[model samples]
Target: MSERITHRLVEVPGGRIHVAEQGAGPLVLLVHGFPESWYSWRRQLPALAAAGFRAAAIDVRGYGRSSRPPRVADYRLLAHVADNVAVVRALGESTAVVVGHDWGSPIAAATALIRPDLFRAVGLLSVPYAPRGPHRPTDGFAAMGGDEEFYVSYFQAPGRAEAEIEPDVRGWLAGFYASLSADTMGESAGESVSFVPRGGRLRDRFPKGVLPSWLTEADLEVYAGEFERTGLTGALNRYRNVDRDWEDLAAWDGATITQPALFAGGSLDPSTTWMAGAIEAFPRTLPNLTAAHILDDCGHWIQQERADEVNRLLTDWLRSLG
Candidate 1:
């Protein structure tokens, strides 16, 4: 499976984007989220390929082999959308269907929203599409964290999260990943991974010594190694730009994604619970939604945790677009 996938760096506006691709049909571009690289889509590439689609997953700028710009604003939402547009053109395709998970979800949505001519369809996993609203994002996040700091707020101060994650990248990643997995996350709702206690690190609440069934030691190492080599500033920069994204996307406020779309979320995932309103508003925000699903007993890593189901849903939706 690994041998079938090929890798390359496609030049975009600011830098080069590293992409891993497979198969030989219409293009399906995959975008990954925070603390993850193109490797996160390892399962989907082959599945989509075998399903008769050319699948390409990319390291969003500032992660893996993709060029990381120095400024914090470099990772804003529009910048990411441009990278996606470039990747599609660089691959010599006029259009594609974009799919994303975690942070990738929003990026994918924005791409389809901003460039509908280039992206014919969109798929969101883990996070649902919510059109830009009236309030500033930072204000909302600040209010969400009454006493404890919201994890996104905690990531605002440059070098703060890096300090905590750089020293032990592997362990931090392991705990972070485990904390979100349905098998190892804390049982109570108060123990959600979205917040960090005042003066305490986000990983402080992470479970130790337990790895999710979907994540092997090798997988953990792959994730850790990338951050270890590049450091976390570029990746963390994405969180810092929430307010910027909110401002940049203002023109599109309340805009509906009219493209064909699909959404799947983990029943147990906090993202699903937290963004329920967005999911409920899909009819208005995602008018062309083909199907929406909540995979029971699943967690944040939806694709990896439930590969077969996600692949079926994705391939089915892709076919339905025709």
Candidate 2:
């Protein structure tokens, strides 16, 4: 959207992944979270380039212009990491600072873990590596539900997430994004994430009648269009590989990332904060972790909700490395 970030098709593990890059210096790969395309980083691309880093944002396996395959198995953890590795190689860089958000955060961590040599540094917005994460992916999901995860467990059901998300994706996404505690999302806002139960059965999760205030009709429409075109099947498939992901990470044990790392958490983000001591456990996963700052004023969409602040943190952190 700004100065037209360069677009190219990167030959990755499965197929050609569409990537957009700007600037020309050390590389920074900005990987986005679920339900988002590379377009989410429109604001940061040029700015990072201006600051002198060859910044690239890519459409992860299932989203945006990148090629999407049919099977949920296709979006496995290893596949995701390999795709990132392929992109890094295609860029002709031996290593790049990898920055990620939400689902991208784990993938970034996994890339640094599964392919440590491929990354020079790591930064995450809204998510971090729990000692349990690299141990096994399913462990994270399982750890969420000590006994029964009526919340996330819903994802495992066949055709469950897809069915629920597709029928009302517009309203769902709009409601989810807009409802994010505005108090948490001051300015930095890109992709707002929230969890809501299917139908009106889980009012406890969405107290304000399923739709929140910030999600405007326009925002809902944008989400609706994307879902309508892509369908939730491919996206939902991400959840299906839970167990398979664990199996893949089984062989890679106790591998802590030694790369300089930056971890940012949204204090109001239930995904991270709700986990109790999870945020504090990050350093154990990275041998050279430097800082872990929780943006007290933000929610899940840290980049979008707190862009200027997030940008400042990232730029400053990168400069610190020099």
Candidate 3:
């Protein structure tokens, strides 16, 4: 929100991307996840800028002010990875410290893996990037649990999720955000479900209530307004490309992230519980992993949930990269 942080649309390889930037130094690119935009890094933009890094956050393709390609195929990992690398070059940098959360984590990982020349260092939050397995991700996912309306499964069918979530974007956003917070997810951090039964609605998964403290009314408005304009098609398309992404990443099946890396997540984040093994074995998966921090009493929104702590950890990690 400060004048120091400026927004602009810059052209990438395939399309134009909207970026928010501050300060000037080593480039630190922030990539947000599902249902979020570049604004998601509001707190970190200034914090990292003050720490002497040119902090930049982009509205990942199909999200905020970025170009939204019509085909679902365009949202694949290869495309997202290319977009990040192109953005770095377009911003006049040969390399950057790529940081991501949730869906963005995998995208960042893919970038570092496929084009390490562009992403010198990597930081992953909330999600861990396990290398591609022998089986297709969709095949493994489809065989998971029975009689359950897996959120990803629900998102597989184009227009279905959009229909359910677009009508009342605010309500959908509120429920989705609340369900992932520490409050609705339980105080004691543990494994939890992120989906509902078949034919179930997303709102039904959470208690009818107000927005969580981490998400303010203004924050909600920003997300809602963006989704209202862009619709859920582009964002959900990311989920739809699971199999394609898995297949596309076949080249890096057993590869490890060979970059200086850092990871931080909220203790209460379901991803922490769900991907505990990967997080624990990060050093093995990412040979150059420098540090992994788990914020106490925090949830999925690690950066927003605990901005000060995240800023400190991120800055310290960035300092180490130099």
Best by TM-score: 1
- C-alpha lDDT (0 to 100) for residue 187 of candidate 3: 29
Residue runs of model 1 more than 4 Å from their true location after superposition: 1-3, 188-191
lDDT of 3 by residue, 1-322 (tens): 3448898898877699999999899999999998788988999999998888999999999998999999999999999998998888889997899999989999999999999877899999999868888887777667664767557777898999888888899888877777677755542223324665676765665646667777889999999999999898989999999999888888788789999998888887878877898887777789999988888788898887788889999999999988
Tens digit of lDDT per residue, candidate 2, span 84-113?
888989999988889998888888888877
Off by over 4 Å in 2: 133-149, 184-222
lDDT of 2: 0.71
**Residue by residue across 73-176, what tens digits does model 1's lDDT show?**
99999999999999999999999999999999999999999999999999999999999999999899899988899999999999999999999999999988
Backbone clashes in candidate 3 total: 2
Residue 314's C-alpha lDDT in candidate 3?
97
Rank ordering of all candidates by lDDT, starting from the highest:
1, 3, 2
lDDT of each: 0.92, 0.71, 0.85
State residue 66's C-alpha deviation in candidate 1, in Å: 0.2
